[model samples]
Target: MGGVDVVYNPYDRAVNDDPYPVYARMRTEAPLYHNADLGFWALSRHADVSAALTDSALLSSDHGPLLDPGASGPHARTFLSFVAMDPPEHTRMRAAISRAFTPRRVAALEPMIRQIARDHIEPAVERGTFDFARDIAAKVPLDVISELMGVPPAERAGVRRRSDALLRYDPAGQMSDEGVKGILSLGDYYRSIVVERRAAPRDDLVSALVADGELTEDDLVAFLFLLIGAGAETTTHLLCGAWYWAWRNPVQRAAAFGGAIGAWVEESLRYDTPAAGVARRLTRDTEWYGTTVPKDARVWILIASANRDETVFPDPDVYDLGRDTGKAISFGAGRHYCLGGPLARLEGRVVLEELTACVAPDYDIDRSLIRRTVHGNVRGMVSLPTTVKPA
Candidate 1:
């Protein structure tokens, strides 16, 4: 961390594997880091990243919050839905959808979420050996979100498969051909749901959106994609990360298994955030650290890096469950903060609670069989082979 020679490219697979070291160097040497080759700037420090996240007027999300080259510019809303919108439009769409995600609604979902988590983990407990990431972590959140969106049990397997496909990225950091196909398929599928809801409304999000008549069919489809896809995918990674990190730290693992579920979930969110950071488009010239960033440039607010900022959390590398994670920016800030934050947290807590209650506290993971996924924005395990003793 001598000079500001840090080079960070989100598309790089090696970096995504263990980016904390690189993030540490960035926070120390180059808080306002820029990668000319990648054509993006990054803010690694907590204060800077927090400020940029809340400063929506200066740093906009109209171009989407991802680094995917194809999903940029004016048409980003086609894929990102309200997440890519700004100001009044975003406010309107967010407000409309938020009614379904209120604290009471999210709280009511706890029982369903817990039952779903148990359903997934019970089989793993019987098997004694299961890929925690794929078999449990992935399925719980997908089924939860699908249930919320009115996706039938018969169709959920296909939905989860295609949703996963949509997150696959090629070496060039763009969605692969399969990824494109997956998204198109999901769009068609969700559009059909919209039509059915229009015909016979139900007590579900899709039906509610149709009844509200606030969004076009296209908008409804995109919002469903963003909500179901991002919501499930991010929580999947978060669960896997918690499992991996807990295994790495046996002391904290004991605490997690010992009724510190809330603290464990909060720390995991800060430690290994699924969506590393989001990209924002600069609306106008901005000055920072004696330099002026030109308008229209892409600036990435490194939430993962900010969560680990030494200035904010001392001994930031340690995965301690007792640490005060009140300042973590894992779910983001400002008007565009994650609409599913409470849901994600609830899912995480309920899953871990079920895991510990169903499986033995000393369950172990097979490091050799673990598989990791590397996307431009999100990073986590694809498979975590764990062996558990039935509680």
Candidate 2:
């Protein structure tokens, strides 16, 4: 189909529902695809996407990772924080954040996270029928992140409501007015947390940031927004995809219930990565597969496509739990590799373990009720109706 025009528009509703087929065509027909009207070039091949993610010198994230027209340029740092930073600035901020968001800290959260998973999964499993996306997949991760950030339990739902709004897009493919409101509301909410922590410190991430004093108030607020925006949202989507895919591939679901849950989680991540792609600003005119992308051009590193590249993944479409997905760029690569990757993995694994242990191996997904998320960047179900028999 190289002779035919390959349209890879993220804003198209049909493409948002099922981007895999379009991604496959793009990978074969135009590994380095460009859309003049949209003003962005896309890389679908595994090598190109991976190399581009790691090559900060040529591809800068200072423009932000979202495709939102309003989120780029100088304004990015105000809301996107270190994600829109490069080199020394990114390095410095990440270092301070890492010290607070340590492996030990993440490990300490396991019991709380697992408990949160049980709290949600048990209720749904008891009902023997539930919307997996709404009932379990969404609540667990959102609560986990909220708890980590010391958001009061009573306010978590409001936080989630704002988050949903923040990720929503308007008919024009731009951030909707609600999304703009979401940004301001979340920023204000996080800023309040920072202010509170300064007066009366608590045993949470916000308090840690306040004590550290490295990041300014704006930096702290932006970082917290990123944590909830990117970290919580992606994990929720990952869980939703995993639950839906497991029902589709019963054998793998059975295997996961039979003790291969780690493989199940990893494979799900590679098979249906949450963040479809990340946008980068091209720093210089770069040559790729006979095309030269100009400086300052927006580039999309198609992570979902890269994970499914047949050259890298044999029989890329099939969901096989045994497949080695080490090469997958699902979380990203190099400096911008998702800082919350480990925590997300932990959340996924623990939830799956708790879920499969309590519920029967066989569960039915209501195909008619599965509603896909409409955002350009994040892809997954907004609702997945499921019925299960108790173990």
Candidate 3:
């Protein structure tokens, strides 16, 4: 890697397909890499990224989760979920949200999730060929989370379409009018549901938020936006990625079918980390990797790069299911660690188990039809086509 001559653009389609080679150069040539074009810094090493993730005192998340610091400020407080909060504010909201996702609560969903897996997969198998992402990967979490959030199954497609409009994450990327409208549409959609849930008071996440009494009407809708955006979408990508990666590595897929699904899931999380890294703002000038990053600079904590750091993971590029990924921060860590991790893992494990056992021992993914997401902030496949056969 002769000193990464290519300017690292997260939105670049070619780079997104396989970010590891570029990430290797970043970790070696510029651990505290700065992209002046995008006006942000990046920490590529596992040590550096992990430090920044846990350094809540220095790195801030109050603005938004996009890499560009100027993308959205506190003034645009319409969708600041706990992911975009700091300190006592984050603590209060996260604690409240955590209560709604207790381990017991998530575990109880196993039966429902298994049923959902069968409901989606069995049909896809019957069809013999289907786009895995649309038919199954995206459905389980959407159904579970939508139902959990009190949005009826009938409304899920509309919610998904609206939530997708929020792909306008960076100012560097031309913020299309469609994306802006999509964000607004989700806000309006959730606002209606919030009002309904408040009036009727059901035992769902939305009702729980409304009942918490800690959020104003505006905050209530914003929280709903956060729930759908963070919970459903991320888990969908995680499931999609797990399937895609498994297909790419037959040995690993076999191991997953051989009672090593947990290892496979963790390695997939580490190797093909969804959400390459998260955004943060520096509170004060900080010296890192022998350079002084200025105060108030935007930084993309490169968790994707860190997950493959040669220092921490030997032969980091290889997708070895036996590799210990206990230290991986794919779901993040510390204060902002994804509250949805356990639920996401539950979803991933259940789906993989069902696929390998009931759907087919192994099925080849249609590499030509698998379309990947080019979004700068998220690592996800939009489509993964595959043909399946009965067990």
Candidate 4:
């Protein structure tokens, strides 16, 4: 840790609130710093982070660091979802879901997705004052995903609550005991849904998985769990990221509303990615940036930091909507690139378009009152209060 002061605990609240400065320091001072307390090596530079993510032979995601150490054993076995699986198995599971997530399939949902966003935003816009995060951004994705997954509209609230609970992690890197229990319960609920779908298949993801005989019940549950958890949560953060940027830069907001919102969304993804970092374990001994990582060592790829690497992006701290560096690691890279990237982008574009079209340009957004989740893994606003004029 020559050039930087290494902090072992990644879950510390202060660190989660604003990790860029620390990441910048690390990238400048110690690009490959090993933390003894956390027992993981951190890769903060753009080059190193990119390399670590793509180097499957060296940095493997098969069985790496658990986000919540306390829930290791049970969570390890239960949470062996596709995200944790290596190739061959990962390829198979990914292939099973690929048909549904293809660009055409996702693009087709644009109209319906826009309608969903309008449905939620129209009412809130009429009200003129509401928590943007809760009322607008958060609600849209859950409804769209529910429709996509064929989780009947009535059961959506339960599904959202359970998914939120399961993903809840504190600043101390610990999950609520109740959250773990809720995850198991969710798994059971999805299992029953799978059984029912088996009896009579439908047109949703659940039915599709059930129709694929190659996937087991556990596999189906794990896949769905990943969908609900990552799918909903990441989009939620993108929404928050949009608002955060708009609030900070009113000029950028105006430009965004003037038909260039897509760039704003992309910049937001780079500036404040939902998943700040991803974990992997070294499968074989490897040397990077003059440091040798022993086999079996855990590593954290600092995605948010890489996005802001000074060597990569000019004036990295500033939020420039027009800057098209085309190198942000927000969706990651290589084999493990986010499969739902198209879906997430569509959701973000729809929400921003609908909101800006109906709401006034200078809508009142309270930046100071905004609240963010304390968890390190998922960075998103918990609440965003704002006022907008009705159409």
Best by lDDT: 1
- Per-residue error for 329 in candidate 2, Å, reads 1.3
- For model 4, residues 245-315, the per-residue Cα lDDT tens digits are 87788888878888888898899999888878877877788887777789877787888889999888999
lDDT of 1 by residue, 1-391 (tens): 2356788988787898889999998887788888887788889899998999999999999999887666567787886789899989998889888877789888989889988998888888999988898899989999998998999999999887787655775534566677778878988999999999999999888887788877788888889889777888899999998888998999999999999999988999999988898889999988888778899999988999999988989899999999999999999999889999899999999999888887777888899777788777788899899998988
Alpha-carbon lDDT of model 1: 0.87
Candidate 1 clashing pairs, residues 3+ apart or interchain: none
Worst 10 residues of 4 by lDDT: 68-77
RMSD of 3: 2.0
What is the Cα-based lDDT of residue 66 in candidate 1? 82
Is candidate 2 or 3 superior in lDDT?
A: 2
Candidate 2 per-residue C-alpha lDDT over 1-391 given as tens digits, one digit per residue, 9 for 90 to 100: 2465888888787888788999998888888888777677889989888899999999998888877665567677776789899989999899889988788998999999999999999889999889988898889988998998999899999998887765675435466676778768888899999999999999998899889989888889989878887788888889988888888998888787898888988999999999899889998998887777788999988999999999989999999999998898889999999889999999999998998888888889999878987766788888999999988
Greater-lDDT candidate between 1 and 2? 1
Q: What ordering of candidates by lDDT runs from best to worst?
A: 1, 2, 3, 4
Candidate 2 has an lDDT of 0.86
- Ten-residue stretch with the least lDDT total in model 2: 165-174
Off by over 4 Å in 2: 1-4, 170-179
- Per-model TM values vs. the true structure: 0.96, 0.96, 0.94, 0.94
Backbone clashes counted, model 3 = 0
Superposition TM-score, candidate 4 onto the true structure: 0.94
